[model samples]
Target chain A: MSKKVVVIYSGGMDSFTVLHKAMQQGLTPYALTFDYGQRHIKEIEVAREVCEELGVHHKVIDISAINQLIGGSSLTDSSIDVAQGHYQQESMKSTVVPNRNMILLSLAIGYAVSLGAEQVYYGAHSGDHEIYPDCRPIFVEKMNDVAAVANYEKVEIFSPYLNNNKSGILKDGLAMGLDYSKTWTCYNGREKACGKCGSCVERLEAFAANGLKDPIAYEDT
Target chain B: MSKKVVVIYSGGMDSFTVLHKAMQQGLTPYALTFDYGQRHIKEIEVAREVCEELGVHHKVIDISAINQLIGGSSLTDSSIDVAQGHYQQESMKSTVVPNRNMILLSLAIGYAVSLGAEQVYYGAHSGDHEIYPDCRPIFVEKMNDVAAVANYEKVEIFSPYLNNNKSGILKDGLAMGLDYSKTWTCYNGREKACGKCGSCVERLEAFAANGLKDPIAYEDT
Candidate 1:
C-alpha cells in the first residue's frame, strides 16, 4: 500500500503541481482545499473539477465563518481591492491573509492525524517569502515543531517547493505533463483570469520563464 | 483605550476563568469559540451566555466542516464512547482531539491579527498535560513560535494556565468571584453533566481541591 499524504490543494498552480508531484512520488494524495471567503472563490470550483477528473479524495472545507474574524486582507475581505502588478511589490502586502497558512496547515495536520497519515504537503514556494511571512522558511520550521508535538501521532509538514520559485515548480509540473489550465491563479473570481493581479502576473511570468504560453484564458492577455 | 486580546473561550471552567482574568487585567477580551462537532456542544451555548453577560465581543466560529476530516476522537466521533474516570488515566486519551489546540490557537491568532490584537489566550492547563499532547508545555511553546511569525501583526499565544493545575485555575476564578454554574465541562451533552466522565471528574476534583462545591448540576450528584 502506498503511503497516504494530505496535500493542501488550493487550485492554484503551485498546489496543482504539488498534487501531481505527490502522486509521482508514489504517495496517495488526499486533496484538502479551504473556502476561506477568498475573492477568487472560483478556484474552489476549479479544484473540485480537477480532483474529480483525477479520482482523488478531495474535501473543500468551508471556513467562511472565519471571514468575520480574519478580515482586512484583500483575499478574504471584499472591502480591500486585490493588489496588481509584481507579486513581490510592497502593494502585494495587502494580499496577506493574516495567519492563513498556519490555520490551513493546522487543519490539514488534524485531517492527516484523523486519517493516520504522517505527512502533509503544502506549496509554499520561495516567491511567497517576500510578502507573506507565513510562507517563509522560519514559519514552516516553527510550524513543523508545533505539528510534531501537536498530536499523539506526529505529522511532518512536507513543503518540497519551499526553496523553489514558481518557475521551478511550473517547470517540474510541465515535465510531469500536468495540465496547468485546470488551475486558477487570478485574485479576481471572474469568467476569465485577471492578468493584472499579483498572483496572475506572477503565474504568467512563471510560464514565460518556462518558455511556454499559459493554457488558461486571461482577460488582459 | 485598553489593549485587546483574543481569548479562546470554550465555556469550560478554565476558559471562563481566563475570560474574566483578561478583563481583570484591564485588557478588552474578544471571546472566540469554535463549534467543532464535539459531543459536549452545550459548552458553546454556555460560552455564548457568559460572553453575553459580560458584554464581550464574541464569535462562534463553525468549524464543523473539519469534523469530517478529524473524527476519530470520542469528543467528536459518536462511534467512540466517552472515557470515564480520572482525566489523567490512560482511558482518557480517547478524549484527545487530534491537534485540537493548534487548530484553535491558529484561528485565534488570525482573529487577533485581524483585530490588531497582539495576544491570544487559551485555557490549556497542567491537568490536560497527561492525556492531551496539544496541552503540554512544549506544544504551547512551539505553537507560540509559529504564532509569532505566522502573520505580520505577530500574535502571541498566552497560556497562563500552562504550569497551573485545574485547582489553581479554579482558585483564581474563586478569587475573582466567578460564577461556575455558567460553565460546562461534561464529555456527554445530555440534559445534565455526566459526573463520571473524565472532564466532569477532573472538574469535580478541581472544585473539591478548592474546598468548594461545583455550582453546576451533574447526573450522578
Candidate 2:
C-alpha cells in the first residue's frame, strides 16, 4: 500500500510542484490549504482548481481567527504594502507574518494526523529563507521534533527542497509535469499578478533560469 | 503595577475559577480560548461573556480545524458523549482529546511569549486527573522543559490548585465574585444543562460541596 502524505498546497508554483513530486514518489497526496484571511484569496481559488484538476483529496481549513491574534504580515493586513523588489532585502517590510509557516505547518500536521498520514510535505525552499525564517531547514527540523513529541508519534515534516532554490523547484516541477501556468504566485491580489512582487519576481526568475519566459501573464512587469 | 497573566479560559468551571484566582493575585488576565469546533460552542460563548464582564483582553484562537490532530477527547467530538458517574473508570471513553491540555497550554504560551507575559494560569485540578493525563502536574513539568526550548524565553504554566478538587475551585470562585450565573459549565448544550453529564455533574457536586446549590440551571437534578 502506498504511504499517505498531505501537502501544504497553496496552488502557488512551489506547492504545486511539491504536490506533483509527492505523486511521482507514489505517495497519495492529501492537499491541504489554509484560509487564514490572507489578502490573496486568489491563491486559495487556484489551489482549489489545482486540487480539482489533480483529483486528490483536498481540505481547506479555516484559521482566520489566528490572524485576529497574530498580525503584522502584508499577506494578512491591509496596512502593509506588498513590496515590488528583490526577495532577499531586509527592507522588505511586506515580508514576515508571525509564525505563519509554524501555524500553517502545525495545522497541516494536524490534518495529516487526522487522516493518519505519516508524512507532511512543504515547499519551503532557499528562496523563501530570504523572507521567512520558518522556511529555513532548522525551523523545519525543530518543528518536526516538536510535532513528534506533541503527537507522540513519528510524524515527519518533510521539506524536500529546503536547501534548494526556486530554480530547483521549477525544474523538479517541470520534470513532474506540473503545469506552472495553472499556478498563481503573486502576493498582490490584483486583476493579474503584479509580477514584480517578491514571489512574482522569484517565480519569473525561476522560469527564466529554465531558459523560458513565465507562461503566466501579469498586469505589471 | 499589576502582573499580566495569560489565563487559559476554556469557559468551563475550573477555568473560570482560575480566572478569578488570577484577579485575586492582582494580575490582569488576558483570556485565551481555543475554538476547536467542539460540540461545546456554548462554553466558548461563556468564555466570551466572562471575559467581557471582566473587561480583560480576550483572544480566541481557532484550532478547530486541527481537531483530533493533537488530542483525542470526547469533548472535541460528538461521536462520544461527555462521561458521567465515575471519573476513575478505566473505560471512560468520554475522557480523551488527544493532547488537549498540552496544545491549549502551548498556544497560551505562544501568546504569552508574544505578550511578554511571565505566567500562564490554567485549571488543572486533581478532580480532572481521573480523565485527563495532560491535566497532571507531571506532564506540565515536562512540558515546561519543552516550552523552555521551544520558545525564546521560559513562560511558567501555573496550576493554582494542583492538589485541589473541583469543590476547591468553586470555593475560590465564590470567594472571588466570579459571577457564576453568566458562566456556562454544561457539556450538553440544550435549554438547560444535562446534569448527568460529566461537566454538569462535576459543577453540581462542587457547588454542593460548598453547601451551595449550583446557580446554573439543569434540565433535571
Candidate 3:
C-alpha cells in the first residue's frame, strides 16, 4: 500500500464523508471506529459495513473502558436521558460527550504513528463547536501541537470539516455517491431514527438545506 | 469525601510512591490502572492489592484494545524481545511505548473531570526521560495544556516526581514504609524477577543505591 492515513470513522454521516474524501484524494485510509459503549452502538455495525464496501482495513477499538471510567456523560450514562431538540438549542448540550474527540484523536495518533501513517483524519465539523469543547478550533490546534511532540514520527491530525457545517459535509457525500442510508445519526438507539434527537435534527436539516431528503428512515419523516 | 485526585497507579515502585505521597498530602487519591496487554499484566493484580491496603477506590480499566491498536512496542507486543541492560543504554529504547503517558494522562483527565477531581497524579520520574519521549517534561507540559482546554473542569496533571530519579523515588518509598515486595518491575514477566532486563536492572540498582535490598524475589538476587 502507498502512504496511509488513519480516519476516525464513527459510522456517522460526517465520518462517512471523511472516509470517502480521503479515498478520492488517493490516500490509503484505514477506518478506525470506537465501541465506546454509547447508546448508539449500532453505529459500529454501520461503520463496519461502510469499510467493507470501501475495501479499506477497519479497526473497531474497544474504548468502552474509557466510557466506563468517565460515566457522567448522557451518551454513555444510562441514568441521564439523551435530550432531544434542534442541535443549536441549549438543551441539546446534554448529548455532549466530554473530551471525546481528544481521547479518540490521541488513540488515532498512536495508531497512525505505529503504522507509519503521516496523518489522522477525524470528522469534527463547525456544528459540534457549540457544545463539545474538544471539537472547538482551539482544542484541535492545541492537540495537533501535543501530537507533534508526543511521538517519534509526529503523526498530525487533519480535520478538514473543522470549518464546514453539516450541510457542507452532506454535499461532499452526495458528490461522492455515498449511500447515506447506511450512516446513522440518531442518539436514540432504535431501529428507526428518532427525528427529534439533536443528532437526527442536524442531519435532517443538513440534507434539507442541500435540496435532498435524508436517505435514512425517520420515525416522523 | 473532600476533593479527590486521580492517581495513575501501575503497581510499580514509582507509582506506589506516588500513591503514598498523595495520601500524605491529605488528598484522597483514586487509583486508575489500565490493563493494556503489557508483558507484566500481573502488576494489575498488585495494584488492586495495594489499593485495598491503602483503603482507596481502585478502578482497573481494560484498555488492552489500545495495545492491540498500536502494535510496535515490545512492552505490549509479545513478538518483540525485551532488551536486557541499564535503562540509559540505546537498546532500551525498544521498550518505549509511543505516547503511553499522553494516552494515560488523557484518560486520567476524563476520569478526573467525571469525578470532579482537581488534579491527576502520575509517577513519571527523571530516569525515563532519556528513553521515552512521552515521559519527558515537554510532553507533560504540553499534555497539561491540552487537558486544560479539553474539559470543562480542566483537571491538571500533577507529576511530582518528574525531577526525581529511581534512587530518589526509592528513598521516598522507604520513608513511607511501603512494602516494595508487592510491586513488580521485571520486563520479562515470570514467577521470579528476571534480574537482567532493563526494568529489573533499574529497579535493583535503585534499591541498592538507596542502601537497601529489594524486597521482591529475583532470579539471581
Candidate 4:
C-alpha cells in the first residue's frame, strides 16, 4: 500500500519538485496550498494546474488573514519592493514572512492527522535556511516534536531538500519527468515573471547551472 | 510601561478568567477568537460581549475550514453527538480536535509578532491535560521553542492556569471581581446550555466547588 502524505504545494519550483518526488516514491500525495494574499497570487492558479496534471487531490486553504497579521515581508506588503539579485543578498531578507512555514506546517499536520496520513512534506531547502529561520534544520526538528505531541497519530514532517540546494531539487524534478513550465517563482507577480527579483534570479541560476533553459517566460530573460 | 499580550479568548469561563488576569497584571491585552465550526459557536458572541465590557481589542479569525479538514471531532461534526458525562470519560475523547491549540497558537504568535506583543496568553488549565495532549506542559515547552525559531521577535506563550484546575481558575476570577455572567461554556449550542454535556458538567462542577453560581443559564439548571 502506498503511504499517504500531505504536500505543502506553493506552486513554486521547489514545491513542484517535492510533489513529483513524493509520487516517485509511491506515496499518495494531497497537495495543500495556502492563499495567504501573497503578491504572487498567480502561483495558486499554477498549483491547481499542477495538481490536475498529476491527478492528485488539491486543497487551497484561505489564510489571507496572515497578510494582515504580519507586515514587513515584501511578499505580502506592497510598500516593500521585491529585491533583485541573489537569495544571499541582505535586501532579500524583506521577503521573509515571519513564521510562515511554521503556520503552514502546523495546519498541514492537522489536515494530515485528520486524514490518517503519516507524513507531511514541504520543500524547505538549504538555500531558504539563509534567509528564512523556519526553514532551518533546528526548526524542523522542533516542529516535528510539536507535531508529535499535538496529534495522536504522530505525523512526521518530511523535507527532502532540507540539506540540498535549488539546483539539486531541479535535477531531481527533471529525473521525475516534471514539467517545470507549470511552476511559478517570481516575487513580482507580473504577467511574465520579473526575472530580476531574487526568487527569479535564483531559479534562473539553478536552470542555467543544470545546462537547461527555464520553461517559463520572464520579462528580462 | 506595560508589555502587550495577546490573549486567546474563546468566551469560555477559563478564557474569560485569563483576560481578567492579564488585566490585573496591568498588561495591555488583545483578545483573539477563532470562529472554527464549533457546536458552541454562540460562544463567539459571548467573547465579543466580554471583550466589549473589558474594553480590550478583540480579533475574530475565520478558521471554519478546519471542520472540513478534521471530521472525527464531535465539536465540529454535526453527525457526531456531543457526548455527555464527565470530561475524563472515554466517549469524551471524541471532543478532542487534533492539534487544536497548536494551530490556534501559531496564528496568535503571528498576530503578536505583527503588533510587537511580547507575550501570548491562553487558559489551558491542568484539568485539560488529561483529555487534551496539547494542553500538557511538555507540549507548551516544545511549542515555545518552535515559536522562538519561527519568529524574529520571539513572542512567548503564557498559560496562567497551566498548573491550576477549573475551580482554581474560578477562584482567581472571583478574586479579580470579574463578571462571569458573560462567559459561555456549552458543548451543545442552544437557547440555554445543555447541562448534561461533558463541558457543561465540568464547568458546573468547577462553579459548585468554588461556592459560586455559574452566571450563564442552563436548560437543566
Give the candidate order by descending lDDT.
Answer: 1, 4, 3, 2
Give per-candidate clash totals. Answer: 0, 8, 0, 0
lDDT of 3 by residue, B58-107 (tens): 99988888986788778888899989899899888788776787788888
Which 10-residue window in model 2 chain A sums to the lowest lDDT? A145-154
Best by DockQ: 1
Each model's fnat? 0.92, 0.16, 0.72, 0.65
lDDT for residue A2 in candidate 1, whole number 0-100: 95
Residue B147 miss distance in model 3 (angstroms): 0.3
Looking only at chain A, give the TM-score of model 4 against the true structure. 0.96
**Native-to-model Cα distance after best TM-score fit, residue A219 in candidate 4, in Å:** 1.3
Provide the lDDT at A71 for model 4.
73
Docking class of 2: acceptable
Q: How does each model score on TM-score?
A: 0.96, 0.80, 0.96, 0.96
TM-score of model 2 (first chain only): 0.95
Question: Model 2, range B25-140, lDDT digits (tens) per residue?
Answer: 78989998888877758888888887887798888877776663444566777776667755666546455655456556756766776677888898889987756666767766
Candidate 3: lDDT of A177? Answer: 87
Could you give candidate 1's per-residue lDDT for residues B1-221 as a string of tens digits? Answer: 99999999988899999999999999999999898888767899999888898899999988887887888888888999888998878887887888888888888888998889989999889988888889999998998888888777777889888999999999988899988999998878888998998888889899999888888888856
Every candidate's DockQ is 0.87, 0.25, 0.73, 0.66
Predict model 3's lDDT versus the native: 0.86
- Docking outcome class, model 1: high
Clashing pairs in 1: none
